[model samples]
Target: MAVAAVTTKRKRTTARPTKTQPTTNAKLIKQPLPAGLPREWYETHNRRLKAMRLAIALLDTGIYHPANASNRRIRTAAERIGIHPPSETTCRMVRSLIHYAD
Candidate 1:
């Protein structure tokens, strides 16, 4: 007597595709100011005034605090004179002015 040969078949499996969902809620993060100022200030003096205003705000808010009181007063004077005070990182940029003497 001869036994019949048995055959077995293996099944192939395929990976299922992944599904992605869009995010509905996301928070925006504050970023640093761009490299240059806005174009509204065509005159150099106007740009300087704007810079002075920003510097004053920064100083008042303690963003650039720990600075010497004398330096702060100097910066305030510069703001009043339409001369934008230099940034804290470049405080040396401010120029000195002298009145005419007889």
Candidate 2:
């Protein structure tokens, strides 16, 4: 009696998706804030901008959940993005942004 050999197919593996950087060289021009604005207004505006930046940085680093964005993590992300360490208020803002992003 002759026996037939059985063949098995191997499973294919796919690589995990990696974050991609912008290929364009687009740059943003820093226009000075409108003249005669109140100091508090300027401060608030700058703080909001910083929070947005930190949030984006954290997202890019694979931090999609707000729970993952601790004060230390947010501050570290700010430092990595060349910004000063964020205040507690700013950290909360960043987490809020991450949370609402979904």
Instruction: Tell me the whole-model lDDT of each prediction, alpha carbons only.
Output: 0.45, 0.87
* Superposed model 1: Cα runs more than 4 Å off: 1-42, 65-102
lDDT of 1 by residue, 4-99 (tens): 334545666955433343244544545554557756534445445455454454455444432333457656755665665755533432221111
lDDT of 2 by residue, 1-102 (tens): 233334555676955443443334645546688999889999889899999999999999999999999999999898888999999999999999999996
Steric clash count of candidate 1 = 0
Give the count of colliding residue pairs in each prediction.
0, 0
Q: After superposition, how far is residue 102 of candidate 2 from its true place, in Å?
A: 1.4
TM-score of each candidate structure, all chains considered together: 0.24, 0.71
Model 2 weakest lDDT span, ten residues long: 15-24
Query: Cα lDDT for residue 41, model 1?
Result: 37
